[model samples]
Target: MLIIPAIDIKEGKCVRLTRGDFNQKKIYLDNPRDMAIIWRKQNAKMLHIVDLDAALTGEMTNFEKIREIVTDLDIPVQVGGGIRSVDAVKRYLDIGVSRVVIGSAAVTDPKLVERLMKIYRPSQIVVGIDAENGIPKIKGWTESSGLKDFDLALRMKSMGIERVIYTDISRDGMMQGFGYESTKRFAERAGMKITASGGVTNAEDMKRLIELQPYGVDSVIIGKALYECNFPCQELWYAFEEGITLDHNFSTARKK
Candidate 1:
C-alpha cells in the first residue's frame, strides 16, 4: 500500500480542521510549499492536497498556491476541492496534476463522472467520498447529501469510475486513527482502488489499512499524524526498506 501525505491548504497555509469543521482548525505551517518539500525529501511518491476554502465556497481560491506546489514537486500530486466543473478539472490537468478528485460533483451530478470518463478515462479522475455516520457529506463535509456512502460507491463504480478516495468526516483531523472497518467494507463493495483518508494517527493505523488490501484499498492519505509528530516519514521509509509490511504484509518498493 502507498502512504500518501496530505497537505490541506486554507488561505495559502497548511492547516487541519477537526471533523472538517472550519471553526476547529489548526495551522501547521505558514507556507505549504515547505511542507511539500519536506514530504518530497522523505521520499513520498505522491502528495494529497485539499483546498479547504475552495471546498467550502466552490471557488478556486488557492489554485495559484497549489500550482506552485505541483510545479515544485518531483512526484505526482493529486488535488481535491471545489472542482465542481469540467473546466476546473481541465485547468488542473493542464497544469500537470496527475489526478483531480471530484467529491460534490460526483454526488450532485452522476452524469459528470460519465462525461469525465469519456474525456479523460477513469484513471485521471478520482471520486472523493466523504461520509459521516455512513451517509455521504458534501460542500466540504458541511452539508449532508442524504446518499448512503457505500451506495454511492456502488453508483460510482457503475459509472465506470475505477478509483475513489474515501474519507471519514467524523475522524478528519481528529488524529484518532482511520475508520478501517468502514473503509474495508467500502472497498469491498466498490472493488476498485480506494485511497483511504482522514483520522490516520500513526504507523499502526497504516498497518490496519494495508491489511485491508483485499478490499481494494491501495493507498492512504495522512495529515495530522505528520503534523503532530506521530509518524515520521523516515521511520516508515525504513520499515518499508526492511520489508516489514503492515496490514497483511504486502511488499512494495521502498521509497528512498
Candidate 2:
C-alpha cells in the first residue's frame, strides 16, 4: 500500500485541523512548497494536498502557492478542495497535477462530475467522501448533505467514479486511529477502490490498513501523523537526509 503524505494549506501555510474544525488548527510549516519538497526528499511516492481555505470558501485562494509546489515536485501530486467547476479541474490538470479530487461539488453538482468524467480519464478524477456518523458532509464538513456515505458512494459509482478518498470526519486529526471498520464497510459496499484518509496515528494503523488491501484499499493519505513523525521510518529518512549529501535529482526518480 502507498503511504501518501498530506499537506493541508490554509492561508498559504501548511496546517492541519482537528476533526475538520477550522478553529482547532495547528500550523506545521509556513511555506507549503517547502513542506512538499521535504516529503519528496523523504521518498514519498505521491503527495496529497488540500486547500483548507478553498474548501471552506470555495475559492482558489492558495492557487499560486499550490502551483509553485506542483512545478517543483517531480512526483505525482493529487489535489483536493474547492474544485466545483470544470474550469477549476482544468486549471489543476493543466498545471500537471496528477489527479483532481472533487468534494462538495460531488454532492451539490453531479453534472459537473459527469462533465469532468467525460473530459478526463477516470484515473485523473476522484471524489472525496467526507462523512460524519455515516452521513456525508459538504462545504468543508460544515453542512450535512442529507445523504448517507454509502448512498453517495453508490451515486458516484453510477456516475462513472471508480475511486474515492473516504474520510471519517469524527476520526480526523484525533490520532485515535482511523475508521477501519467504517472504511472496510464502505469499500465492501461501494465496490470501489479507496484511498483512506484521516486519523491515521502510527505504523500499527498502517498495518491494519494493509490487511484491507484485498478490499480495494490501495493507498492512504496521512496528515497529522506524518507531520509529527509518527512513523519510525520517518526518523530514518530524516537522519539519512541530514547525514548524507543527497543528489538534487534523487527525488525525481519514479519508484513505487
Candidate 3:
C-alpha cells in the first residue's frame, strides 16, 4: 500500500485542521513546496494536496503554489479542494496534476462527474468522500449533504467513478487512530477502490490498513502522523540500507 503525505494548503501555506475545522488549523510550513520536496526525498511515490481556501469558497486560491509543487516533484501529485467544474479539473490536469479529486461537486452535482469522466479517463478522476457519523459532509466539512456516506459512494460508482478518497472527518487530524470499523464498512459497501484518510497515527496503523486491503482500501493519506513522527520515521528508509533494525522502541528520527 502507498502511504501518501498530505500537503493541505491554507492561504498558500502547509497546514492541518482538526476534524476539518478551519479555525483549528496549525501551520507547519511557509512553503508547501518544501514539504512536497521533503516527501519526495523520503521516496514517496505520490502526494495528496488539499486547497483549503478553494474548499471553503470554491476559489482557485493556491493554483500557483500547487503548480510549483507538481513541477518540483518527479512523483505524481493528486490535487483536490474546490474542483467543482470541468474547467477546474481540466486546469489542474492541464497543469500536470496526475489526478484531480472532486468533493462537493461530486455531491452537489453528480452530472459533473459523468461529464468529466467522458472527457478524461477514470484514472485521472477521484471522488473525495469525507464523512462524519456515517453521513457525508461538504463545503469543507461545515455543512451536511444529507447523504449516507455509503449510498453516496455507491452512487459515485454508478457514475463510473472507480476511485474514492474516504475520510472519517471525526477522526481526521486527531491522531487517535484510524476509524477502522467505519472505514472498513464504508469500503465494503462503496464497492470501489478507496484511499483511506484521517487518524493514521503510526506504522501499526499502516499494518492494520494493509489488513483491510481486501475491502478495496488501496492507499492511505497521512497528515499529522508524518509531521509529528507518530509513524516510523522517514530515516528508516536509509536505516534499511545501513542494515539497521528499526524497532518500535528505537530512537526516532525527529527530536520531538
Candidate 4:
C-alpha cells in the first residue's frame, strides 16, 4: 500500500479541519511550500492538496500559489477543490499537476468527468468522493449532496474515471482512524485505484486499509496523524516498502 500525505490549504495557509468542520480548524503552517518541502525531504512520492477556500467558493483562489508549489517541487501533486470545468482541469494539467481531483464537480456537473476523461487519460483524472453517513458532501463538506457515496463512485466509473481519493467527512481530522468500510466498499464497487483519507490516527489504520487490498484500495492519505505528530510517516512508509502486511483490527466494534 502507498502512504500519501495531505496539505489542506485555507486562505493560502496549510490548515487541518477537525471532523471536517470548517469552524474548527487548526493552522499547521503559514507557508504550505515549507510543509511540502518537509514531506519531500522525508521521501514522499506523491502529495495530496485540497484548496478549502476554492471548494466552498467555486473559485480557484489558491491556484497561483498551488501552481508555484507544483512547479517548484519534483514530487507529483494531485490537487482538488472547486474544479468544476474542463478549462479548470486543463489549466491544472497544463501546469503539470499529476492528477486533478473533481469533488463537487462529480455531483453537480458530471458531464465534466466524461469530457475530462476523454481528453486526459484516466490516470490523470481523479474523483474525490467525500461523505458522511454514507451520503456525499460537497462545498468543503459543509453541505450534503444527498447522494450515496458508492452511487457516485459507480457513476465516475461509467465516466471512465479509474482513480479516486475517498475521504469520510465524519472521520476527517478526528484522528480516530479511517472510515474503512465506506472506503473499501467504494473501491470494491468502482473496481479502481483508491487512496483512502480522513482520520488515520496511527499505523494500525494503515494496516487496516492494507488488509482491504483485495477490495481495490491502492493506498491511503495521512493528514492529522502526521501533522499532530501522532504517527511517523517514515514508519508507515517503511512498513509498506518492506511488505509487512499485518492483519487489520477492523472488527465491527472498531468501525464506530
Pick by TM-score: 2 or 3, better one: 3
lDDT (CA) for every model shown?
0.86, 0.88, 0.88, 0.84
All candidates' TM-scores? 0.92, 0.91, 0.92, 0.91
lDDT of 3 by residue, 104-216 (tens): 98889999999998999989999999999899999898899999999998888988899999999989999999999999999888888999999998777777888899999
lDDT of 1 by residue, 61-165 (tens): 999999999998889999999899889999999999999999998888888888888899788899999998889999888788998888898888888888889
Kindly list the per-residue Cα lDDT of model 4 for residues 111-197, writing each as its tens digit.
Answer: 888888778998899999988888888877878888888888888888888887888888988878888787777777778778888
Q: What is the total number of backbone clashes in candidate 2?
A: 0
Off by over 4 Å in 2: 234-256
| Residue pairs in candidate 4 whose N, alpha carbon or C atoms collide under 3 angstroms | none
lDDT score for residue 165 of model 3:
97
